[model samples]
Target: MVWGLRLFPRAGGVDELALDRALSAVDGPVRAAFALQLLEGLDESGVRELLAEAAVADPVGAMRRAARLGRPDRAGAQAMLRSGEFDPCTVQTRPSDLLRRRHRVRAAAVAAALCVVAGGLAVAVEQGARGGGEERSPAGVFAPVLDPAELMRTAAERWADTSRVDFTAWPARGGRTDDDGLLGRALRAWAEPSESVRVSTTPGTASVPPAEPPQLLFADEVDGAAVVLFHDSADRVVRYAEPLSGAGGAAIDFARTDDADVTTGAAVVVSRTADGARFLLAPWIAESTTRDLLAPDTPGRPLEVGPDGVTAEVPRPGAGGACETWPVLQLRSSERIVEKHAFLLTDLGELAPTHLTYMPKPGRGTPARQPREATGPDALVAWARTACSLRTLAGSGVRSVNNWAFAEQKLPEGGASADWVCTRADTWRGPGRVLVQFLAPAASPADPATVIADRDDTALCSKFGQHVLAGTHWRADSGRWYVLGAGSRAVTGIRATGEVRGAAGGPTLAVRAPRDADVELTASLREGGTLTAVH
Candidate 1:
């Protein structure tokens, strides 16, 4: 709350005395009512969430209002009340419900009441959702609510050790990045580890600073591994390096839809691949491009993100192509777009992200109008599927990116730890299964038995079973398959299911493979089923 005094000062009126009075009565419905008045200083979504989640006493009534009037709008809520649902004076619910809807509204009842009593004074908690633009001083800024990307990144770093980093120095040309979004941020923590990783548009470079500067967003280590924050003018990483982590860190990656001009300031972008790939580790600055990335015929500027959540104009991608605005996700090995649902990372510190359904799609999308922030990965996936009419088989971008599925034993995974990544079309038609057992684990002593594979439905047989070990059965069905016997422990981590429909006959589908292994799939249709192997 460094810049708190400046950013939050009662947006409507409460000029100090009016504020203090409200601080005393914070709690229950009265507290929420006051907090509602003070919400003007907060982000739009944060306010909406507060009303939706908080126990307003008449929850069922409020929900009815929400259904009829949409949400929080007094007119709508009043209209809904006509149907005999609520009274802001009596909106209440169970404590357990508070837990379930915590993300919606979990403001301290006491604090909210006090703030309201103080006129329109916003409590500090009310101003918690600020992102970028509003702050004048670095200290004055508030970290945007814990977004899905940052939270996931933190989790990934913790479980897989991507956080262990070195802050020996900052790169000369490195600095804060403008390329940022609800997904994640990029920063350069130290001097480029090697000269080969260095680059400069002006053709000359210099040594970076050596100090624990405030500008450095964060620096940490996990399992002895290191990651440093890079900025446009202050980071030490001299050049962007490939293979950010030798082997262990290959699993962690970052991306967002960057269909904008890459030529100037910061912009968020999703990637095609991430393993050992070169990226804008820190922030930098340069000229600005006047082109929009969404135009199909537009030749856009090529820019990259910097450390302080900024972007810098750079030359075109080495292999030139029109940089169109897409809702993409980029990893070292590949990149894809958020074509389906826009999943906003939550501040709850949990893994379950929320999907915002703004457009027409399957039963999943919600037709709610929302804030204009750009889209995220979930949205892009759905979009790609619908646009391309991708079937049970892999989609175009996934095939090109060469997505893989790791062995069944991957741990602490979710956009980190180099685990198997498979983005399936939610509405695929046939049976989908990853090969549980490679056909020849004994014959070939190469790698694990798990390989990225699709079930080969050789329209012939139906009940296919093989004994991996006595009592452990590998069964395949026309629609479902089991890696272990019926009573076996659930394979929680193994990405076992995929859609499998196409002409009944077996089709060699795309799936990750353990270095060198043979995978087998079995399925049935009107023509029965058969088993087959893939290298």
Candidate 2:
């Protein structure tokens, strides 16, 4: 007989139900001893004190007897442990109510162990008094009658019609979920948050509740605090947690989602502990890995996925500031699309991962798709080192970013080619801006290149607009100076006036001039237009 359940309709009934039935058949002291230690997660001292108040003869003997009766198959036991059954919040009887029925049981004794205040509401169980209440009863009264399987099934059925991935498909993990008190509060806060519950939302995120019951995504202890993540709908991801310092009330944070988030998934910075920041990866992701952006060719390290998709701890971004190209996480979806995400420690304690978008070259048409891994090391390394790529443009509503080498000038003494590159960032809501930098070769791979002549928002770097860039830098090796100017590839020729007099054909111009020359440079575009350089 499979799992010894031939007596019931199903053979596989040797689960928490079977265990509960076995415990109920035992004496009251035995049942109380088992539930107090196993379900409440109380120490021997706490269990003994509560059992003593209930007038049990020997707490240790009762506990030993209870363990023997309650033991189930190994698999059943693990499932039972993960399920968080018979928690005080789920059961109908409060410790106060149970104490009232016992002659020797005191409210103080039970409250010290079972009663808890969460979100300004009591989490203790409360049930109606039984008839002939003075008589002793088995502690099976505290056992939960409802099974969690039905709830999971109901949630799945509710999400069946949605096009997005069902939230029920993801296993719930994280937080001190085994802690009945904390898990109960988290569940309650999501299902029926009261006026006293605190709520927060990121810009453009929705604060409304879902049409149906929200789905549980994560529940675990993080950074010494109880944290929970729930999906209100395909469009909203909500997080509820206790204050990290234990000084303030619990709060709910909201983040808006779109098709981009669904296809690429995300890895959120859930907590920052002594070890470093912890990440919670989206459940739909097939795999997650990270590589140092500064070292583009280095092998990427695979991050181990924990229960419910949480990742192993990672080092927080160093103190080098935005100049430092922090490591990037690459999340590969089931569809085989790999996305790159950048994370930064922000004042908004819990950090959300920022999605990186790639801008196509000017004539390449609209961005064909969302950003993915760069095609080559040069592109990846260039983006990784650009100050405008990750940090400065993260929250600026950026939809895409591109780094274009507008001009390549050979060093004054035939040293090497130095590139004048402009980074164009386009926002989702329409406006775009540009940052220009000059990159000179450096000695080591660790020091990829140095950026100079950095300028921002001074020139047009869009396909629909045309402009030119000109700047002068002194060369110590050549003992002379030169004026450099460049326009888009469409430029046919360039002319210089004012203190510097010279003319050069084609898209780039380099002419020997005095260091302080006030040069007025103009460019003729192949598309029939003359544009002046912005200093």
Candidate 3:
């Protein structure tokens, strides 16, 4: 009926389409609040309480936002409520009628029992006449045609001689392999996962199914739950898990793997087991160590890795908290590289684990010469923790991330200079993108950086790229206005001509110009080339 109203409606002159548009303009929580209050006829407090149960941060605020958008027609809603009215009390019944109905039900049950007994006797006599009658084993009567043991042996042999460090080479672990139902379910999930199944692949990893059946990686029990890990293809890692007691539906998850993961030397998939969270390490991982990225100087804590490449239960980070401690995994791969991975337990959603990799401006630096050295600059690590990069790019198949300080300019009226940084996320497939941030001078190390722009594909911060960062006015302490312009790192000097007469060298230019003037700026690069600004 509610959908009918939406499809064709003029309820007290309220256009349901317009009302829907207004509600859709708000966030999800706010939209939910509207549905509960208006359609479900819930009170404001009840709606707020339900929203709180759903983990909404500001349930009352959501309700307030819904109310402010204007309410629909109460009279029309009341009329709809009246339209479906029915009274149970209007029907009549008697004890005499109930007794007759009970008698009829009892007679039907006896007749069914008699018919079953006669049919069984006839079947027994027929079997006796044919040959020696024998009862079949009930346990094996409906066994599945596929053998779990045979399946495992075949999959294992397929990858025994392979040189790749993928799921095929990974040892099969998990105590639940004997459970044919669980194994079959996992295999079916791999071939054709349900639409509701959650899938997360890092930027460059493949998300599609393999051309053939996936190879088994692990089929053992982890902390009381049956977990089956496999690979859809060489580059795709898939995991399926369910309760050992068969109490809940199975959950299937997918992640991509590549040479970058191998070169970094270790990849991990964070899975939620029955007891807690467990880190599922790749086959090539020799050892797993973790440390608090928030406290970089702290000594690493080694986690015991089982023969099956599963780590003991690790503490799960609280979702949405101002990250108190960023957990960094130093997974030592068989190739002897300490791969750094940082996990963020964000409120956004479940994400496939991505490593914290650093790419220095090609010739500027290498990925840390020391085995114990951290991946990127200290400032970049700080930015990753405080800024929204991790939260935003968690599902972008980010193979690695590098923070580049593109340009820095001393504020015209400030005590310190502001840094313009571009954070590039190199995905698996090939091309990468960047996030541009205008980090104001920090009074302390704890100050958070602000994101100025996030460009999906741009060469604005790369080497040999030529583009002016378009000028913006900054007001001084004494109320004087100055126009500031910055260019790429290759830019050697900047000249402001019309309405602003100033020249400055080294990427940044500042001139005391009118706020609304038609300013013309030109940038000179080290390659003896000059280019005019275009915004």
Top candidate (TM-score): 3
Model 1 segments more than 4 A misplaced: 1-280, 283-301, 304-505, 508-535
If ranked by TM-score, best first, what sequence of candidates would result?
3, 2, 1
Per-model TM against the reference: 0.20, 0.54, 0.59
Task: Rate residue 290 of model 3 by lDDT.
Answer: 67
Q: What are the runs in model 3 whose C-alpha is more than 4 Å off?
A: 1-169, 176-181, 192-209, 258-260, 263-265, 273-276, 297-299, 314-323, 335-351, 359-388, 408-418, 428-433, 457-485, 495-503, 511-524, 527-535
Q: Whose lDDT is greatest here?
A: 3
lDDT of each: 0.25, 0.55, 0.57
Evaluated at residue 116, the lDDT of candidate 2 is 46
- The ten-residue window of minimal lDDT in model 2 covers 143-152
lDDT string, candidate 3, 1-535, tens digits = 2321222223323444455445544678877876687667899889988998998876754675566444456454334333322122333322335446678889999999999999999878867886756653222233322224435333433333455544455555555556667677666555556775544444345555455545566677766567777654466667777766866566776655555335332444546733346766766666677665555445669888876667776654433325455555666555332344333222122234544533223123333221112344554345444444454554446655555655667787656776665666656555666666566655554355655455555554444343435455666768888877776656778889887789998778888887687678888977787876534
Better candidate by TM-score, 2 or 3: 3
Which ranking of candidates, highest lDDT first?
A: 3, 2, 1
Q: Total backbone clashes of model 2?
A: 8
